[model samples]
Target: MTIPIALTIAGSDSSGGAGIQADLKSFAALGVYGASVITALTAQNTRGVTGIHQVPADFVTAQINAVFADLEVRAVKIGMVAELAVIDAIAAGLTRWLPKHIVLDPVMVATSGDRLLAAEAVEGLRTKLIPRASLITPNLPEAAALLNEPLAAGEAAIESQGRRLLAMGCPAVLIKGGHGQGAESIDYLVRDSGVIALAAPRIATRNTHGTGCSLSSAIAAGLAKGEDMETAVRYAKAWVSAAIAAADRLGVGHGHGPIHHFHRFY
Candidate 1:
C-alpha cells in the first residue's frame, strides 16, 4: 500500500533540525509520506537562526497550489509564516481549497530566541488562521501573544489559553507546556467537550531543536493514519519526549540542539 500523505507548510531550516526539516523527519518516523510548501528560508545551524528570507506571498501560494494539485494530503501542519502577507496567502488558500485536517503550530520564535514571524503577523493569525485549524499548538509565550492576554505560569495558564483559543474559533487547542520552566512538561489539549493534560517529566538535553515542529508534525502524521485528536496529540507527545531523550549531542549551539531522528522505536 502507498504511504499516507501529509503536508507541512513551514519555513526551511538549513540546520535540518526544525521547521520543514523537522516536520519531514517526524512524518517519516511515523510512517507517513511528507510534502512541504516552504514559507521562508533560514540560514542557521545549531547555533541559531542568523538570517531569514521570507518567500513572497505569490510564491507561497504557488507552492501550495502545486502540491495540492498532485497530492491527496490527509493532514496539514503549518509552521513559520514570517509576514502578514504570508498569513493572508495561507488564509486565502485554505478558504479556496480547505484541507481536511489542519494543525497550526503558530511558530513565532525559535527555541534559540530568534524571531521568525513578524510581530504584526500574530494579529493576522488570530483573525485568519486560528478558526480554520483543527487544532492550534502554541507554547506559553505564543499562546499569550495570540490571546493578547497575560497568563499565569504552569498548567493553569495553558488550560486557560486552550479554552480561550477555542473561543477564537479553533475546534481544539493544544497549549504546549514545553516552555513552562518546570520539572514536568505538561501539555494541555482543550476541545468543546473538555480538556486533557498530557504530562511527562521534561528530559534535560541540549538536543531539542525542532521539538515543536516534531510534536505538531507527529500529530499530523497520527491524524493522517486515522487516529483521533486526543490519541494523536498523546502519541505525539510521547514520541517527542522520547526524541528528546535520544537527542544527539550536536554541541554546536548554546541552546538545545536536535534529538536523534533515527533511534529505534521502543
Candidate 2:
C-alpha cells in the first residue's frame, strides 16, 4: 500500500504557527504525506507579521508542476494567497492536474490582524478558486468577503449564510464559528443535502493562531485518504480541538500563538 499524498499551497510561517507550516504539521500529525508550495514567506511570529516576501508567480507555478509531475497528489488545500497572480498560478496548475479534491480556506486576515492577501485577490479567488473547491472553509470575516455583507455577530445571527455561500457555486461550505463570541466553537457544514452542525466548548486560550489552517488541512488530508466529507470534518474538528487544548503558552503577544501538535506522542 502506498501512502496517500496531500498538497498544501499557502505561505510560510517562520514561527510555525500558520500557512504552509501549519498545514504541513497537521498533515504529518494525521499520517498523510505532505507537500507544500510556498506562495509567500512572512517574517512572522506569534507577535505578528512584520514583513512578507511573495514568491514570483512563475516560481510558484514551477513548484506546483514539480509536485504534480512526480507525486500522485490526491487532495489540495489552498490558503494565504499573497497576490492575485499567485492565485491565478494555482488555478492554472489545477486547470491541468484537476486533483480529486480541493479545500479552499479563504485566509485573508491573520489572527494578529495583519492583512495577508491583497485586497484585489479576494475577487479573483472567488471567481477562480472557490468554484473549484470541494469544500470552502471560511470563518465569519471570510464569509463576509464572499458575500459582500457585514459579518454576522454570532452563529445565531447568521442563519442560511452557509446556504448562501453554497449558492455562490462551491458544492459545499463550512462556516466556522470559532471566532464567534461564545462558549463553544460551532462549525456549520452546508451542502445540497442539508446542514450539519458540530459544537464543542471553546478553550479559554489565545494559542489559536493556526486553528483555521489546521482544520482545513486536516480535512484535505482526510479527503486524500478517501474519507467521506462528513467523516473528514468530524475527524478534523476533533483533531484541531485536541491541538488547541494542548497549545503552548510560549509567546508574548496580544494575539494567540500555535499549539503543540506532537505533545501527546512526544
Candidate 3:
C-alpha cells in the first residue's frame, strides 16, 4: 500500500518527549510515514535540558539530501534548530527539494524553560525558513522573539501578531494561545485573506512536554493526507487536545511528561 511521507528536521530529545522523537511519533499517530534529520542531540528530560551537541551543518545537509533523494516527502516539519549554521543548511536543502507542505514550528524555548535555538539563529529563521513555510506555528514567546517585541497582551494582540508574522512572507501563521490567560486555548491562524480562530478547552496537565512539536507534525500529517490548511489545523488541534487530556495516564517522569500520541488507538 502507498503511504504518505513526512520529514522532520530537528533535534533529538533523549527523553523522547520533544524534538525529532515527538515529531516522528506525531506523524505515525496521524498515519503518515515519518523520516528525520537530527540537527542536534539534546540531553534532556521532563525536568530540563542539561546539555546539547549540535550535528555538523554539512552532516545535516547530507541527512536531508538522503531523505529527499529516497522518499517522496509530502510534508516537512521543522523544529529545534540550535544554531544559525544548521538553519542555513536546512534552508538550502528545502530550497532545493521544495517540499509541498512545510510546517515551521519556531521552537525557541522548551517546556522546561530551556532555550533551544540560539539568539542569532532567530534572524535566519525569520529571513530564510519563514519564507518557505506553508504554515508556521509559534507559541507566544517564540512569536515575540521572532518579531523582537513583547508578548501579545490578549486575543486582539494575538491576532495582530499573527498578521505581522504572515507579513514576514510565510503564507500562513498560527500564533498558539496556550500561553495566554483563558479558560480555553485559542490559536489564531492568520492568512492574507482573513483569520481563523481555533479554540479548545484547556487541558490541565503537567504532561505537556511536546505539545508544539506534536501539533505541527500533526498538521503536516493532515496536509500530507490532502487536507486543506484550515482542515489540517482543526484536525491537529483536536488530536493534540485529546492527547493532552490523556497524558496524565502515562505517569512517567517526575516533571512534565509527554502526551499520549497514540491515545486514539490504545
How large an RMSD does model 1 have? 1.6
Candidate 3 per-residue lDDT, tens place, 1-266, comes to 78999999999999999899999999998899999999999999999999999999999999999999999999999999989999999999998999999999999999999998888888999999999999999999899989989998987888888889988899999999889877999999999999888999988889999999999999999999999999999999999999999999889799999999989898
- The model with the greatest lDDT is 3
lDDT of 2 by residue, 1-266 (tens): 89999999999998888899899989999989999999999998888899999899999999999999999999999999979999899999999999999999999989999989888998988889988899999998889877898887755545567888887688999999987877888898889998888888889888988889999999999999999999999999988988888885455355577876665576
Candidate lDDT values, in order: 0.88, 0.89, 0.93
Worst lDDT 10-window in candidate 3? 154-163
Q: Which structure among the candidates has the greatest TM-score? A: 3
Tell me the lDDT of model 1 at 169.
94
lDDT (0-100) at residue 237 of candidate 2? 92
State which candidate, 1 or 3, has the greater TM-score: 3
User: Model 1 — TM-score against the truth?
Assistant: 0.95
Which residue pairs clash within candidate 3? Answer: none
For candidate 2, the C-alpha RMSD (Å) to the true structure equals: 1.6
lDDT of 3 at 3: 98
Give the lDDT of residue 132 in candidate 2. 86
Give per-model CA RMSD: 1.6, 1.6, 0.7
